[model samples]
Target: MLVEKNLPLQPFNSFGIAARALRLARIGSEAELQALIRHPDWSADQTFVLGGGSNIVLTGDVRQLVLKVEIPGRRLLRETERGWLVEAGAGERWHDFVAWTLQQGWPGLENLALIPGTVGASPVQNIGAYGVECQDRFDSLDAIDLETGEAFSLNAAQCGFGYRDSVFKHERAADGRGFGLKGRALITRVRFLLPKPWKPVLGYLDLERKMAELGLVDPGAQQIFDMVCAIRRAKLPDPALIGNAGSFFKNPSVTPEQCADIIARDPKVVHYPMPDGSIKLAAGWLIDACGWKGKTVGHAGVYDKQALVLVNRGDAEHPCTGGEVMTLARAIQTSVYERFGIRLEPEPVVL
Candidate 1:
């Protein structure tokens, strides 16, 4: 483990939030991680496992020791009668891995192409897009307990996967049955089971529009990957140029009766019936309806093109602080709640 003092965090996070880690340690291998945990001075310190920093909002300098997972490798473990089993290191870039899977003739991960963060962070957030969730392809994962320095493995059921949630996001129940990994567990590697007879997921609205625009009936994985990348580029701002998390709020789910009430009041309210019978409302539409798009508060502003995104209207010399971003987010949430009686939850982890 290589240790650094007062590490600048702007380059690490996608939002480019200006902050610092009081102490940071980069663990590029399992041995390094184990050695660091064995050190008497550091073993008891509070540590945060940081992946790609894409899904977090650092409000201030992190007081806890930051353990940056950089352990890296990728390989096809084995092919089963049902599907191809692949594994990647905790620190591997998420989007690049998806693209690599396609290049190697694996078709299942194409729909999730171009998502930010690392493979280790993927399961924690249950990252999904275009109708394919991590849980759908997740085989299992390996991790180590920060306090105990003990290694353990878990399958999908143990993950407690939900919409943008998992065991890693919650605290362990007092009864200790449902384990919440969260800060306690540091993921080392992730494995994916991409099934055979891979079928295209063309049910998403953007994919449908792409198919119609191209005058094609069926699209392949590469085509879908290209289309998703194109659509995202057209809609969302690149973090390299503009600092922002992809989506600011979760699409609030409501019952059919509740959906009807909202639809009755606002005829143009956008919604879709989920397979589980809940209706998912468009959070961006609600925010746009409240006139938050393109509005600026301090260094934070709502993206005009897509109200779902919040941007950093600051430069390297003066980047947007996490406080400003959260303040703006809270305001948006309150407005949406007051107007529609629906509480909008943020997608990113605020720290």
Candidate 2:
């Protein structure tokens, strides 16, 4: 274990919002994670779990110790009659894991290509792209309770997954406070249930239309993976190159009645009703309708290619500050709220 104090975190987060942590720790194994949780000097409430740090923004210095998970390993756990179950350490980069699974000819997770973040954070947000979310293929995960340093496994149902949410994210105390922070449960490993029978999901109009134009009746997992990568490359700016978290806002899910009312007001309002009866509306369109496309304020600006993504247009000599990001975020939120009577929440975790 290594511990440091007053560390600057500009290199850690994708948003590039400069911030400092009071203390920082790196754990190399699950046992180390458990030991840190049990350390008398460290309080669960004062510790925060950090992975690849892609889906996060720090508006200010983190007052607690940021524990970065360094444990890394991946392998196929078993081969069932129907599919293969693969387990990966939570510290693994999400896209690398997805590409690895594809190399093995695994038939799931292809639609999730190029999503930023780590394996552990994947379940926290039910990370998804194209037309598939992580929950669709999640089997289970091994987590540690930060208070007692006890390990436990949670099945998919126990995860309580929803659009960009999970029990891990929505954790609440008996008094309606937050859990995980005080308990310090860290996701040390993730298990994925991948189907052997290839099921290409092209439900999104862009993908479905592309397939239709190709005159293809059925596409395989590899083809879908290539198409997803191409589409993502066309829209999302690679964090390694431009430094951005993909899709700064989630598509707002509303009630069918709400959707009907909005549609009556503006037929251009696009929405799709989920099987669960909730209607998902395009946040990008809403933002664009508010005339935020290609809009720039100071060093922070909305990406011209995708209104859902906010980019840092500032350079090294004039980097965007945390305040600027928050300011722009507030403006977007206020604009979307005024337009549709619903507040648009930022998708990335704003620390």
Candidate 3:
């Protein structure tokens, strides 16, 4: 294991936030991970497990070991009547894993095509897009307990998956003890239950429309996957070319009664009733309605193409600082809350 100091973490994170780490360690195997955690330098307050760094905003230099998990491999673990259970290393790029699964004929992950992040981080936030969340297919995760070297397999329920929140993300503090905000539970691997049977979830209207345009009647999972990629490419900016963390805010889901009230106030509110009868309103529409689309307060601004995404428009003198991003997010939150009585929450982990 090579441990470096004062490492630049800006390039690692998708947002391109200029931040450094006091110490950085890249562990390629479970043994190495355990060794580092057991090292004298390790502490609950000074250890952080980073995956792809796609869903985070760094405010300043980290005073800890930004441990980047590099373990890699994928395999079919089991095959039952329902589906084939596939397991992958936590460090695997989520999009690459999705593509590999599609090629291997796994059906469940196709709808989640093109989402940026690592496999381990998927369950952390129950990462979802276009009607599919990680919890829907999550079987289990092999995670290392920071306090104890003993490895434990956490089932989906054990992970406490919630809307953009999980046991790893929202396990907060009340009085004292507990991991609270900064815990070092290292996710080593993730297992997903997928099916060989082609099940196409064409719940998103844009995807359905695309299928219709292509004359696809009851398309298969792969077809849906291709369409989703096309839609995403047209809608979201590529993080490689432009720095962004996909939808910066989660679409606020409210009760049907609340939706009715909002609809009465502004019929233009775009909302879709979820399976549980909860209504999910478009975050982008809300932000745009608040007059933030294509608006730039500094280097950080809302993307011209998509209102839901905040972009770091390459440092035109005043680079996109963390403070500016926070300010814009606060403004949007305040406006949306005042207008619709719904408070929008930032999806990214702001440090």
Candidate 4:
């Protein structure tokens, strides 16, 4: 329950944007959070829950009271004949948790390896890589209502999962039809259901290339994890080295007719047919097609290797501001829209 004032936030966020939290508190357990809620000066509306800070853009100093979640633990909750139910504290590093699950002989999360952020933030973003998403293996999560200080749980359906979206991402509807949690709930623990008789997910192009190169007809979970990590490292700059939130934009989905129109203009347009009738376009291909790679704007720049990534080009002394990053992102969005008539939505949460 200790509060710090004017806390530096550059190290917390992946973008390395220079910013500060006006007041920050560390919440290490459910009881601590409840105690904070019961404080005389506590205001739920003025607080912001921060996890790994790996999926956000800080436009300026955070005026909201920042609650840095540091609760930590992981264990096999239960094992059934069908699958293994594993649980992790909200503050656990997502990549480390995935690797741990694999080491313990649990298998569903391999394809999502190397993704940035915390377990608490995973479902909020419905994080996905290759062909697997958090919702694919989600069992449920424990959270506390900030206003009421009441604890609750939600299954996958209650999460209302979508492409990089969940109930946590939207504001509560006025009419109550939307039923979003948004700023009202703080996730504490997440449970994952990793099924038995596990089979690797190997549908993405990069993975297929690895299989072909290695002559791997039946690669194991660990092999897929290794390949995913290698591929991501090859294309994305490590946040430790270059400040970046991986894949800045979400792949836009369009109608088949729209895809046909783009294909007619640029026959090389990269796209994949979804299980639904919609077609998902490669956002990187669109940005690259518009000539954005290696381009810089102020202190923010597009990663030279991956057009989908927006990076901080400045050093710690003269770091990029969230404004510069958003400016570059907007410019890229405008260019992609003007050329392809499709709007690219950024993936990171902008604050």
Best lDDT among the predictions, by candidate number: 4
Q: lDDT of each structure? A: 0.91, 0.84, 0.84, 0.94
Q: Candidate 1's residue-wise lDDT over 1-351, tens digit each?
A: 568999998898889999999999997877788788888877533888889988889999998989999979999999987899999999999999999999999889998988989999999999999899999999999998887788899999999999999999997777876676778888999999999989889888888998899887888889999999998888889999999988989999999999999999999998989999999999999999999999999999999899999999987677799999999999999999999999999999898
In model 3, how large is the Cα lDDT of residue 118? 90
Candidate 2 lDDT by residue in tens digits, 249-282: 9899999898988899889987887898899999
Residue pairs in candidate 2 whose N, alpha carbon or C atoms collide under 3 angstroms:
none
- Per-residue lDDT over 1-351 for candidate 4, one digit per residue giving the tens place of the 0 to 100 score: 789999999989998989999999998999999999999998988989999999899999999999998889999989998899999999999999999999999999999999999999999999999999999999999999999999999999999999999999999878877778888989999999999889889999999998898899899999999999999999999999999988999999999999999999999999999998999999999999999999999999999999999999998678899999999999999999999999999998899
Instruction: For residue 215, give model 2's deviation from the true position in Å.
Output: 5.0
lDDT of 1 at 164: 93
Model 3, range 1-351, lDDT digits (tens) per residue?
689999988788998877798988996888998887687766766677888999888878888778887889899998888898999999999999999988987789988999999998899978988888899899999988777766888888778777877788855566766543237478889999986564767878898799889999888778888999999999998988888878999998999999898889889989998778899899999998888898876677899888999988755355466777888888889988887788999998888
Global lDDT for candidate 4?
0.94
- Higher lDDT: candidate 3 or 4? 4
Model 4, residue 344: C-alpha shift (Å): 0.9
Q: Candidate 4 at 147: error in angstroms?
A: 0.4
RMSD to the hidden true structure, all candidates = 1.2, 2.0, 1.9, 0.8
Question: Candidate 3: lDDT of 190?
Answer: 97
Candidate 2 TM-score to native: 0.94
CA shift at 143, candidate 3, in angstroms? 0.5
Give the per-residue Cα lDDT of candidate 1 at 174.
Answer: 75
